[model samples]
Every structure is written in C-alpha cells, then in structure tokens.
Target chain A: MTATTPREATAPAKSTRGFLRDNALSLFFGLLFLLALGGQAAAGWADLNNRLHTDGFPPMPFGRYMTSADFAVDVAENWQSEYLQFFLYIVATIYLIQRGSSESKDPGKEGRESDEEQLIGAYAKPGSPAWARIGGWRTALYSRSLGLVMGILFLLSWLAQSIAGRAAFNADQLRQREDPVSWLSYVSSADFWNRSLQNWQSELLAVASMAILAIYLRERGSPESKPVGAPHDATGSES
Target chain B: MSNRLLAVPLCALALCAVTLSGCGAARGPQDAAVVAATHFAAAVSQHDGAAACGLLGEAPRTELEKSAGKPCAQAITGEDLPGLGRIAKVETWGEQAQVRGSSDTVFLSHLTGHWLVMAAGCTPRPGDPYDCIVTGG
Candidate 1:
C-alpha cells in the first residue's frame, strides 16, 4: 500500500541515529573542512610571523594575521580554483565525451537527454521533484541547478580573489618602497595573473588527471572507477 | 521552495560583504601609516633630534648614526633636514610608507607600536629605491 506514496516520497530516516548514519558523508567532510581550515590558519600565521621576524619586523598576533590581506588573498585564491574545477567538470560533462572514462557521459548520449528520459513534465512520477513536474522556467532552472551553483560559486570566489589579491599585492609593493597602483592596474598586472594562472593550471591538471586516469584504472569499489571486471572500453556506468 | 530561493541571494550578499571587508582592511593599514609618518616628520621639522631618533627603528637609527659618524642626536640635527611645512601626501602599503611634506619626503617603516623613520630627505631615483640623504640601519 505504501509502495507508491504520491509526492514527497523517500522521507529522511527519522530516528536520531538513523539521521547521523544517513548524513555521515556530509558530516565527515564538514568536520574535515573545519579541521583543515584551522590547520592552514595556524601554519600560515606561524610562517608569516617567521618571515616578518627575518625581515626585522614585529610578529603579528593570530587575530590580526587571520584578517590580513595576505591571509585573505591566499585563502580566496585556493577557493576560486577549487570552485572552478568543480564548475568546469559539471558543465563540461554535459556535451563532452571521453571514450571510456566513467566521469564522462555515454559516448552517443551527448547533448541534453530527452524530457521523457529525464523524467520531467508528464514523465515525472508522483515522487519526482515539484519543479520537474511543474514543467516551466522553474523546471528548466532546477534541471541545471547543480552546475549553476558551481558556476556562481566559481565567479564569486574569483572576484573575491581579485579584490583580496589587490590588497595583498599593494602591501607588498609598499614594503618594497614601490608605489601602489589602482585596482584596475593591479588586476591587469602580471603578479595578479600569475597567481591566478598558477592555481588554475594545478586544478585543471588534477581534474583532467582524474578524468583520464579513471579510464584505465579500477578503484575496486569506488564509484569514480569502472567495476573490477568491467571492460576497459566501458563508458559512463560506474560500479 | 522559499528557502531554496533565499539561498541564492544570501550567498551573493555574503560575497559582497567579504569584498567590502577586504577593501576596508586595506584602508585601515594606510591610515595607521599616515599617523606614523606625520609624527616622524614633525619631530624632524621641530629639530627635536632626540624625539626624531626615538622614532627611528633600531636598525634605521643605528644606520643613521653609523653613516653620520656621530650619535643620533648630534648627527640628526647636523643634516639640517629641509623644513617640512606640512604633510602634503602619504603613500603607504603593507608596512612601508612615504610621507611627503611641502619640501621633503621621508620613508617610514611600521616596526612595533609606531612607524619609524627609515629614510629622511628622500627623492625618487627612478627605477630604484628612493635616494635618501639619511640612511636607516
């Protein structure tokens, strides 16, 4: 009788223990994020202070160091690169094909799949998302929500990187007894582009490495890899 | 649905706040630099060699004394650093500053509590560190 509960099916497990178990993946990553961020802050602060002392300057307190443009720019640069990697991966997989990589869409299934195949509009089951059943702009937007979020985050983080980087670069310029430039000038300077390109190249390398390497390598049970016995020519279907 | 819509604007708002905060941080350090430069220049103009020397970072003061072949108090007054009518402009980045008065320009370093005069009676050398008549250690 409960087999085909109309909309809002697959309700989250309600028990306290069940909730934790169900959400463990997100919780684990969230914990790691905080720990790693704290570690970076502590290490960055110590390293900066050490350099300042070597240069005959006083050490900055932890609070001040955290808020410094140096810290802000460094943090924002990495953030932008990470978001860029995810954004590119999400958007690229839609139309791009890799012969056997599980990271890519099936070779012949290129382009957006048909509405029926995507379970949208009339094809949306009772339990399908409300926007999918609504069949309009909301449905269209929600369809690509994941990629949209990644793109937005990438742009925002990149903007933050630029602003923070300008401040940090100016500070360094003054320290060297050189004049500081306007924001526009700083953005166009080689220093700014170098920081951005260096980070972007590394991220691109890592993502491309993963996408191509998965074609020939099997990770046993990981969804990123093909099954242990799956043919090397297999495409898209994860274990 | 409402919560989902709200998230987009909320994220945008947070980003705006971060960018503004970074700009604010840059402005704050420059203001601190201005205060440091003004005090150093005032000491030099008033011929308070001791006060001026006190404002010299330890390294700069040592350098000044070494270059002058005399004590800071004796050497500073002897240079006859041009009279600085008023602070005309202050340029600061990171922990360094160039304070330009009506007739003179001085470079200062943010050391500890206040800025220290690293170089006084300075002029742009074009593609080099400023040429300063007075040297800091």
Candidate 2:
C-alpha cells in the first residue's frame, strides 16, 4: 500500500557560528596583512634612523619619520609594483597563451563567452550574486572588475610613490649639501629609477617563476595546480 | 565601488592638507646662511677637528698662525667654542659668528669659513669651532 502525506517546507536556519567558521581564512589573511604592515613600519623606521646617524644628522623622532614622505614612498612603491604584477598576471592569463602552464586558460578561451560557460545571465544559478544575474552591463563589468580595480590601484599607488619619493630624495640632498631637484627632475634621476627598477625586477622574476612553475608542480586538492596524477599539459580548472 | 573611488580624491585632499601643514618654515636667506655655518660648527664640536679646520677664514687662520706661532687649529678646542649654538648669532656686520669654545668668537663671512662649505653648508673650523669658549675654565 502506498501512503500519501503532506510534506512541510521550511528554510534552513543560518547559524552565525557556521558563517564565521566558513570565512575564517579571510579573517586570518586580514590579520596577517596587518601584522606584516606593522613589521614594515618598524623595520623602515630603524633603517631611516641608521642612515641619519651615519650622515651625522640627529636621529629624527620615530613619530615624525612615520609622517615623512620618504617612508610613504618606499612602502607605496613596493605595494604598487606588487599590485601591478598581480593585476597584469590576472588579466593576461585570460587572453595570453602559455603552453603547459597551469596559470593560463586554454589557448582558444581568449575572451568572455557564453552565459552558460560563465554561469551568468539566464544561466546563473538561483543563489548566484545579483551581479551575475543582473546581466548586460553589470555582468560585463563584473567579469573584469578584479583586474580593473587592481590596475587602478597600481596607478594610484605608483603616483603616491612618486610624490613621496620626491620628498625623501630632497631631504637626502639637503643633508648632503646638494641642490634639491624638482619633482620632474627626481622622477628621471638615477635615485628614483634605481629604487623602482630594483623592486620591479624582483617582482617580474617571481611572477615569471610562478607561471612557469605550475606547469609541472602539483599539490593535491589545490586549485592553483592540477591533481597530483594529472599530466603536465593539463590546463584550466584544477578540479 | 563608486564610494571607494571617492576615497582617492579625499585621500589626496587630506595629503595636501597634511603637506601644507607640514611644509616647514623654509629657512630665510639669513637663517639659511647662518644654519650653514652652525652646521659646520656642529661637525667640528663632534671632534672632527680636520673638518672644522677646513672651515676657518684663510686670512684669520693665517693671522693666528703668524701671531700665535702655532697652527690656528692648535689654538681652538671644544672647550673654547662659543658660537656652536643652534641659533647662530650673526653679527651686525653680516658675518656669521661661529664659536671655537665658550668665549672665543669667530665671525665667518660669506664662504669665509673656507672648507666648511665643502659639503654645502659645512663650515670647516680648525678645532672645536662649535664649542662656546669657557670664560673662566
């Protein structure tokens, strides 16, 4: 005998604890970022004071040094370059071809295509974010927004670096009893270019190493690489 | 996203405000010149006698050697420094007064301190050029 009964429909209750637990990685990263920033500040302060003492000037107060453009520029320039590397790498991976590298999408997948493939527009799942469902302009922009924002940040931080670098260089010049250069002149000076190029060369080398490394390197259950048993030529989604 | 973008301009404005406030009072021409001389004296006071010796007025240094029968630098000491204070005492004669000890005062004319200007505001004195000459001691 078949029995028929009315089924009750109820939404699952969302627990705050579960949400916090799920997002623990993000919280951990945020704390790590703050800690690293503090470390940079402390180390940079000591470095500046050392230079001052060597130059025969009284050591500037730590609080005053913190407000100086020299520290700001040193920090910002490094930051901008890092963001630039990631932004360029992120966008380039979409369109550029790099054979046998896990960082690249397959050569043929050059551009955004098919709502179903991207899970956007009508193909977006019921629980997808509004941006994916909204379609048209919102979806189009949201698709590339990560790279776009990073690129913008790179430019802004680079500008900040230039401004701050000018001040720091000027201070050094004053101490050395040399005529201070203008902002434009400083941008072209060996001091500015050397500091910039040294940082940039390291970043580019690291990026290149990462992209090429993923071709053969594998970590089990990691999205950054294919499965341990996967062939070296395997590309696209790791899972 | 737009709100976040707004932060750029706001940050720029704040930076400008801070910079404006931070723009230190640029040493005036007279102060600039005096600071130059005092900087030299400070170097001398630090026992860098060679550097201080380089800052002496050639004429006065030569005069002292001829009159005292010794190198002008041998006559100066940190104890004899008088004008090494941060506030440079400029004589009405447009000379920057540099101290050798607490009492001995040497007024340095423009670039007269010789090698003291070697590294831009550096004034080379013969000895403890910065120390105010001790009157009794």
Candidate 3:
C-alpha cells in the first residue's frame, strides 16, 4: 500500500506564491534596496539643503536634488565597492582556502574541482543548465560566469562612480572658488582613491570577520555558519 | 539549476544601470547657466544694479562692494558693463560655467539651487582665470 506524506496530501495551491516564495531572498533584498535608496535621496536632499542654508543659498527642490550628481555619486560609490567585494570573493574562493573555516572549501581542494565532480558536460544531469550541456565556449563561460558577471558589474559601477565622483568633486571645487579638474585628473586625485579605499576597507573587514568568525560560532540554521553542533574544525559545511 | 542564481545579480546590475541613466538623460546645467548670465546682462543693461547684484554670486557681490567701498546698488549700476550679444558658445564644468556671447564672456557658478554670475564682462587673460570688470572673489 502506498503512503502519502503531509506535503503530498495537500493539493497544488497558490501558483502565484510559488515564484515569490521561491525567490524570497531576492525579492526581500530588492525591496530593501529601493527603500534604502529612497531614504538616501531624501536624507541627501535634506543634508544638502541644510548646507545651502548655512551658505546663504536657496535650498534645492526634492525632484531636482534626486537627479543631482551629488546623489548619483553617493549611490555609485557604495555600489562599486559592494560589487568589487562580491567579485573578489567569488573569484578568490576558487584558488584559496582557510582550513577550518566554514566559508572556505577543504584545504586540499584549492582550485576548480574536476569537471566530472562539477557534473557538467557529459556528466550533466537532465536538469543541468543549457550552457553546461553545450560543452564548448558556452560551457566554459558558464563555468566562470558568476565571477565574470560580477567583475563586469564591478567595472561598470566603478566607472559610474568615477564619472559621478568627478562631477560632485568638480561641483565642490567650484563652490570653494577653485578650478574643476578633468575626469582623468579627478580619478587620479586623492579624493577618488580615498572614497574608494574607505568603502573597500570596510567591506574587506566585514568579509574577513565573517570568514573567521563562522569557524567558532554556532548559528543553528544559517548557511553562512556551520551547523550549531558542528565541530570548530569542520570545513566546507553549510546548513 | 545554478544558472538561475546568476539572474538575480544580473538583473540587479541592469536595474542599477537603468536607474542611474534616468538622471544621465537630463542635461540642463548649461542652459541654466546661460539663463543666469542672460538675466544678469539684462539687469546690467537696464541699469538696475539691485537686480544685477541679486544675480551675482555671494563672493562676487561681496567682493565688488568691498573693493568699491560703496553699496552694490551704487557701485554696479555705473560700472559701464557691456551689453551681451547673441550667444556664441557655452562651456559647463561641474557647477561652474562660462557663457561666451558675440561680444562678452560671462562666468557663472551654480550654488545650491540657482546659478549666479560669478563674473561678468570677462575677457581672456592668457593662461589665467578670466579677468572681469565685475569680478567675484
């Protein structure tokens, strides 16, 4: 006789919820990004207007302030550093190891694992990615696509940061009764590097903290940490 | 498949590119500078020093008054500032702009919300910032 489990006993339910529920993490973060960005714009506008008042100038309109280079540069600078962090993390993990950290792979597996072990090409399952099944440049690209896409995004965001930063810096210079520099000059200036480095250093610190902390911490269900009862020396283990 | 995981970041990057480009498509700074210069020139031509001074950036207005040892209304109205001609060119960099007319050059600074004349009746000074009859510090 066949036996039915609790989940199987239930009829197919809300089709609409399946997509959102399955992608809850992305949706959650996406909504948070919008809220955070909106908050930034509002706060930035208010902060700018406060400075304007102190300088004996008129305050900017909300609509105009949102479109200003000041806002764009502020947003882009953070974005570039975050993308840079993810890009470095994704690429670095392939060839690096921390023996007892849950964040790192097993020490002996220091490079890209074997193709068969990765279940790609001939070893690909029926549900494998289309690119992985193609077994040529497509497969090769798919293999490194995460790092590649992240790297591309990091470059794009960094470029955006440079352009917007120059505009903002130039505006400040003009306000200070100084000459505005060219984009190339601005990028090479201490201001640009300072902004970039400050964000980068923080991200590096956070990532390092996570990698090292998870080795000794107990988080019952977080994929980032080893299982609550896991040994401190356990590596390459996730919830 | 793991391929689906890539879509989130790819979409995020696209969204970011699109959002930032929304501001990218708008180009109004140069025109705003032009308007400010034109208004200042119009005020100067009308011998309305109050209006002209009103259009002047804080530094320039204060500088003019300090140097002239007189009120802006008295000092600026009688400066013999030239009449602006048809627009020849406009160069904008960050919050600073230069509007070149057929007969004169006007420099403007965008401060806070409005553009103001930083210098008017400016001429080439050869490897230096333009020297203006009506100058701001």
Candidate 4:
C-alpha cells in the first residue's frame, strides 16, 4: 500500500452510493407510505361504495375516488401535522434548554452564543461555507433559515389541508342537497377543526414521546438517541 | 462545436422525453372542478351524512330545517339502493352536472353534492336539475 498521504486523509469524502446504505429509514418509510396509501385507498373506496348503495347514489370508480376531496384531505391533513411537528421541534430546539433530555441543547449552552461558539464571524476557518464567513444579514438569515423554512412549509401544508378538507366537506353537503361552504367558512368549521385536531394530537404525542424517551433510551447507532453506553444524564450532544 | 450549439438539441430531446414519460397531461381547472363535483355526489350517495353536510355552502345549509330536508340515512346491512350501484354516468362542466338516474336526473355541483345528514330531511335543494348555479343540460 502507498504511504498514508495528508491530502488523502484531509480530503472530504463523497456521498454514499445508495439510500439503503445512507438512509435506511427514509427508504423503508417511503415504501411503507406507498403500501399504507394503497390500503387506505382500497378500504376508503369500498366503504364509500357501500354507503352509496344504501343512499340511492352511484358507486364511484376506484381511480375516480382517488381524486376525491376526501382522499386528498385525509392525506394532506396527516402530512400537514407531521410537517408541523417537525417545524415546531426544529424551532423549539433553537431556544429551549432541557436539563437531561437528549432532545434539547444542554442548559449550560442555552440561548444564542458568541460568534466563535457558532464558528461564524472571526472564528470561521478558511473553508467555511460562505454564509458562515459573511458575518452580516447573510449570517443572521442562515442562522434562522432552518426554522424559517420549516415554519413556511408547515403553513403551506396546513393551508393545503384546509383547502382539500373544505372541498371534501362540501361534497358531502351537495350530496344531502345542501349549499356549499366557502373556503374561509370551511377553515373555521367543525369539520376542518376536527380533522386538524385529531392529526395534531397524534403528532404532538409522538414528538413528546421522542423527546422524553430520548433522555434514557439508547438506539445503538440511531442519531435520535444517545449511544447505549452514554450516561442517562447526558444532554444535547449525542455520543 | 460549442457547448451552446449542442445544448439546444439536448434540451429539446429532454423535453420530448419528459412528455413521453407522462409528465405532460396536466389536469386543467375544468377537470378538477368535475372531479370535485363527482366526489361530492359520491360522498352523499353513500349515505355518509357527515361527509355530505361538509360539502355544502353556508347559504344552502344555513337553516337547520333546510339542512334537515335532505338528511342522509345510514343504510341497513347488506341492503343496497339500486341507484348507488356502479356509476352509470359522470359528465362535468366547470363545477356542475346533470346526473341522470334510471328514474330522475339529480343536479350536482361542487360542494353541493355531498350532504351527509343524520336523517333524510337535511339534503339541500338544487333549484332545478336544468337550472343549477352554472347552466348545464
């Protein structure tokens, strides 16, 4: 073998070949989503057909049902809540401090620190990302960019859910020979609120469970938790 | 040859490939409106009272009595309504349609098709099958 060269040692490595090697959970969940979605579609369509037959209405085609507001709202509401969970978690992590929980920054390291602590301003090395070295509005923007993007995405998804939910609800009204609701009215209605709250409750529960469980739990190589050998008292930085 | 000269043909070829790969059939507003209407109609026909009520506008379901007139009734086990079988026809124009039943023609419009009710009294009244909010025969 050739002598160990400094250049070879210092050079940054390239990304891994496949998602399975890089992000196994992402790939797994993606497949799971498709499978779950297919099951939901089948079950929803069947349920819908049964009701139609009882009410003197025509059963819809399977493909056609896929485009229904019911399907869209159901999917969108769940997606919105999930994204909202992530968004809230991201933003909360920035300022909040937890004493012993793995999900939070250490109490000692609470609040925004100095430029050197953040590796921005004068402490930035030669090869730092451009935003880190800029040290002005750019740096300020970059610092909060993650939360900002997450918040915006959460809002957009929530809006999408509302729009789709309203449409689905309105379809029901028409069936009973009732007038349709406006988008604004739908947003405030019990129908929209019910869907939103149900999804929000589940998402909050999952996030809370993760935060609390991470305090003592160990998941081998998972970054979401501390290393198995790490002390239960350890906070923030994972081993 | 310069890269620019080659890029033009490459871009055109890429566009053609994308279209061939089924990325071009974007659903228009009209199509979306029809789908919305159909979804509404289907929801109500299924006897999903709650879902049908959700599809109505404030003007239509504002009064409790009015809402009660076309209420949805939950079907009994195994018993099916003849009209609720297979979808015989779906013709959409913007956000309205004249759904022809074996016996009667029902007027369907976006948000006005699905009106789920605890009773059969809450179903909304479509002014007339032929004279809907948007005109369609």
Candidate 5:
C-alpha cells in the first residue's frame, strides 16, 4: 500500500476545486475589462462618427475606428494613469505609514522589513518562491518584482499614449488646416499634459479617498477594510 | 511563476505599441493623398472649375458658394489659387492628410474610403492656422 503524505493528500482536493472557482476574482475582473472595452469602442466609434458627419466627412466604420489612433490614445491614457496610481501605491506603501488606514502598513512596521520578516534566504520555507530561497541579488530583485512590474506597465502605457496621441493630434491638425507638429512637440504640448494630468488627478483622489475612508469604514468581509467590530484605530488589519 | 505570467502580457503590450506606432505615414495612404491633391491641382490648372469643385468636400463647396454668392464651380475658378508644381511632401494621420506641393498646400480627409479636399490654396500664417483660399466650415 502506498503511503500518502499530508501535502500529497491535500493537493488532490485543492486541484479538484476547478480553475474557474480558484481564479474567480481575476476572471471576474477580466470579464468586466473586456466588456467595458467593447462598450468604449462602440461609444467612441459613434461619437467620432457624429463629429465627422458634422465636419462634412463620412462616418468611419467600426473596424477602422478600432485601429485608429483616436481610440488607441483614449484607451492608453486611462490605462497609463491607472497603472501609475497602482505603481505609486505599491512603492509608497513600503515606507509610508498611515496610523489607521487599511491601505498602509502599521506605523511601527514602516520601511522594507528584514529578510527574516519577509521569509527570504535562511528564513524562507521550503515551499517559498525560488528567488526567496536563493538569496542575494535574485532575492533582492524578487522582493521588488511587484512594484517594478507595475512601474514598467505604467511607462509602457504612457509611451503608447504619447505615440497614439501624436497621431490623433496630427489628424485633428490636418482636419483644421493647421500644420502637424513633431512627436516631441506633441508630447510637450498643453494637450498631452492636460490629458495626462486630468486622469492623474482623478486617480490620486481615488487612492487618497480609499486610504482615508478605509480607516473609519467597515465592509464586513472585504479584504480592503478592517473587520466590522475592529477599532477605527486598527491599522493594516483585514477581515 | 506569477512573474513569468506578468512577463507575457508586458511583452505583448510592448510589441503592440511598437506595431501600432509603426503604422504612422503608411506608404499607401500617403500615395493616395498625393494623387487626390494632384488631381485637384490639375483640374484647377486646366480651368475645369466644375471638376475642381467636384473634389471639394460638401461643406467647403457650400461655404465657397455662400461666401461668393455664386455656385462653387464659378466662384472656385475666380479665386486667386496659385499653380501647384509637383507634389513635394505628404503627411497622413488617421483619416486626414496634408499634401504639400511646390507652390501650395492642400488638406484632405478620407471620407467613405475616398480622399476629398477639405482645404486648398493654403499658406502658412505665423502663430495661427493656415490662411486658405477655400476651406470647409
């Protein structure tokens, strides 16, 4: 008879939970993202067409508009700002402390914690991530991987926004019988800065609101909020 | 494992942005825009007022008639439009393009898959929009 270890016995039951059930959170958000994108495409296409008609141009087809810089710039601008917010939040939370906000670390625990506290090197469990167990540069890099990825994504999205924005701006210039500026000029233009700052202001406000509101509000079972019975002074404690 | 997953989307996004930006100033659209501008210039030079006016966008044609108190074909020929030499340069962005000739510049918009002149006989004005002989509202 084969002997089953505790980990081996539990592995089969965990696997049987099904992929969709295990990934429900990510799957739900992914679906919402696709739906919202589709809705944006439809609405943007109609809006562009309406303006084109008023300007004595024919309405653009749905497929053409989807590939156009107008749609690309709009999508990229919003994406870049959202990623920037998350990137900033992830990095700032490392050293910043908010006394009672669930979004921040406890005041006494601010800054990058020790290797033992983070389960790196000799302190890592056998099942910890490979980089965490390996130590040295790899461990250092792995520790910052989340914030690094978010920062990179923000930069990529911003670059996409600039490229697409120049194209869209040039198109409008042509429509208005004005000269189209270079990429560098467009990036430095008031229009570009306006678009970026508008989205950024909203995102910063949202992050600030969440951090402050979570201090006093209780969302019962939400991981983003302290437990319903927990004191308002509690920090970094989730249900 | 999660990092590898993130890497996939990151790489994909980078590739997509590169591809999308690379689409600017495509050869086909530039050539088409130049052809449309050349056709309009040729019509003007040949004194075929009707043909030249036919190339104008609906709004521009209407604007020309309203401003001149006459039909577009008649008023368009009377304008002091300079002779356009060979096509010097073309820049296309999305459904809009500007074709610059040796002597003049013309703006066109791609409508219904065809390039139509939106403004013609345009001259650069310092710190302002190009002053054009014919323009759409």
Candidate 6:
C-alpha cells in the first residue's frame, strides 16, 4: 500500500469530480438564479396579461412580454440594488468595524492595513497573484478590483433600470392618454425614484440584518456564521 | 470553466439589453403609430364615423355605443372630437403610443400587432391623467 504525503492529500485531485466539487457553490447558485429568473418571467407574463385584459387590451405573447420594457425594468432595478448592496458592504467593511459580528473585522484591525499584512510587493509569497507580487499600479487596482467591479455593475444596471423604467412608464402614460416625458424628466420623476428606493431599502435592510444577526447567531457548518462553539463576542471568526 | 460560465451569462445580459434598447428606438413602431393616428384623424375630419369607429379600440368603441345609446357609426361623429391637422409628433413605448397633431392628441394601443386608437381629443391635466373626450372604459 502506498502512503499519501500531506501535500498530495491536501491538493485537489485533477479530475472532473474535483472541478465540479470546487465550483459547486457557484454552480448551484447559478442554477437557482436561472430557475428563479425563468419563474419571474413566467409569473410576470401572466400578471401582465391579466392587467391587459382588465384594461381592455389584448394579451401579449410570452416572447413579447419577455422583451418588454416592463420586464427589463423589473430585472434591472433588482440587479442594480443587489450590486449596490455588495459594493457598499465591500467598501464599508474596510473602514467600518462591528464589535461582535462575524461579518466584520476585529475592531482594531480596520482600514487598509499595511502592504505586508496584505502580502503585496516584497511581502507577497510565491503563490500570490501576479498583480500582488508585481506591485505598483497593477497591485493598487487589483486591491480595489472587487469593490470597483461591484460599483461598476451597480451603475450600469441602475442606468439600465432608468432607461427601461422610462419606457415602461411612458407606455403606462400613453394608456392613460398622457404625454410621454423626456429621459431627463423621467429620471427626475417620482416613478424612477420609487423603483430605485424600494429595492434599495430592502437590500440595505437585509444586509444590515445579516451583519447584526451574525453577532448573536451560529450556523455550525456555514462559512457566513461563526462556529457553534465560538464565543458570542467573537468577531470575524467563521467555521 | 468558471470564467466561461460567467462570460456566457454576461454576454446574454448584454444581448438582452441591446435587444430591449433597440426595440425602444425602432422607427417601425413609431411609423405604424403615426399611420394609425393619421387614419383615425382623417376619418374624423371627413365625417366618416364608421371608418373612425373601426379604428377605435374595443373598449372605447363599446363605451361610445353604451354612453351614446346608438351604434358606433352614429355615436362617434356626435362626440366632440376635433379636426386634427397634420401629424406633429409620435412617441411609442412598447405596445402603446401617443401621437400629437397640429390641433389635437391621440392615444393608441398596439393590440394583436395592429395600432388602435384608445383615446382622442385629450388635454393634459396637471399631475393627473389626461382629460380625454373619448377614452377606453
């Protein structure tokens, strides 16, 4: 019988099974996202048809409803808010501290710590990313890449929400025999702010709830929560 | 593999956005709306009540008949519909449109791929729906 070395045992197996296992979390969530989106489309189409019938309009085809401004706006509004939530949480965590939350850093460990602490430039190990090892502008940009990407996605989806929202709003306006407002006018209108603020409030609330809840809660096997045996005062400790 | 998976959805979202934005800006829908508005206005001006009634949406047609206690042909001409002049502006937003003529405005809905007038002789009300002389119930 061959004895397995610690390094060999610790290293992931080079196989399809290993790949699937490694990516299981992301893959699982991706599948849920597609299924949920499909469900939303189907439900939204039916609801829209009901409204159309009530208003004496003909039922819209499924394909047409999928491509409509109403659907686009609905999807974009939620997407923008989600990205905004992640962007805010990521950037805020660097400066903000929670005394007893697993989601936060130890109170004294706040702010962008030293380059050594981050393993950048001279402090970077051999296995560190190329940008971290190389340092300079690449390192600086790479350091903020996660937050930057989230913020960019938020902005893009928010812009999309505005465009699609205006189109949907104008369609409703025409239904009521009202004039369609200009893009600038639409952006400044209550309809735009309402859609944005509603989603924003919910996302903010959920994030706030998670941050505070993690301080008192324990989920044994979850990385998001502290180990069950971990003290209630423990901060940033995951299972 | 993970990168490719991410790229696929991102590409799909981009494509969806492009398709949606394209739909909003298309000239075909605008032209169709304009044509419907023009036909309705022309029929009204010519005192061809039947032709004008035919262009109206089902609800507006039924409402006109119910309120007037007469057939759509006789009832539409009796309403205070203005003689709309040349088509001045057209705005279409997914299955609905608003067309403004030199003298009046017309609202239309695209039903089963055909533009039908929902309301005519509409005047803007401050912070309220347009006060339409003819509207769907």
CA RMSD (A), model 5: 4.6
| Candidate 6 C-alpha lDDT tens digits along A78-126 | 9889889999999999999777788998878889999998999999998
Per-residue lDDT of candidate 3, residues A9-114 (tens digit):
6545555578779988888987898899999999999998897666545577888776667787788789778878998999898899776688898877878898
Question: How many pairs collide in each candidate, listed in order?
Answer: 4, 32, 1, 59, 0, 0
Tell me how far the alpha carbon of residue A78 in candidate 3 is from the true structure, in angstroms, after superposition.
Answer: 0.7
Which residue pairs overlap in candidate 6's backbone? none
True contacts kept of each: 0.28, 0.01, 0.11, 0.00, 0.50, 0.50
For candidate 1, the per-residue lDDT at A134 reads: 96
Model 5 Cα lDDT, one tens digit per residue, A43-132: 999999898887677788898988888888888889889889999999989889787888888777878999888999999998999999
Query: B1-137, model 3: which lDDT tens digit per residue?
Result: 24345455444544443443323323587788888899889988888889989889887788888889999978888787887799987656545677789888887777767888877877776546666888755
- TM-score to native of every candidate shown: 0.84, 0.62, 0.78, 0.61, 0.90, 0.90
- Consecutive 10-residue window with the lowest summed lDDT within model 4 chain A: A11-20
Model 3 CA lDDT for position B110: 75
Docking class of 2: incorrect
Model 1 ranges off by over 4 Å: A1-16, B1-22, B25-32, B84-88, B91-97, B109-111, B135-137
Model 2 spans with C-alpha error above 4 angstroms: A1-20, B1-137
Look at candidate 4 and tell me the lDDT of residue B3.
Answer: 28
Consecutive 10-residue window with the lowest summed lDDT within model 6 chain A: A8-17
Q: Judged by DockQ cut-offs, is candidate 1 incorrect, acceptable, medium or high? A: acceptable
TM-score of the B chain in each candidate versus the native B chain: 0.71, 0.42, 0.78, 0.34, 0.85, 0.88
**Whole-model lDDT for model 2 versus the true structure?**
0.59
Local error of candidate 5 at residue B27 (angstroms): 1.9
Error of 5 at B2 (Å): 5.3
Evaluation by DockQ, superior candidate among 3 and 4: 3
Model 4 lDDT tens row, A1-239: 78977776655443334534677766777679889989998998898779655644557778767766566666667767876897888877778866567788877676677888889978898998899888899999988876676666566557667766665565565454445556678888998899899999999999888888888788997777787888878888733
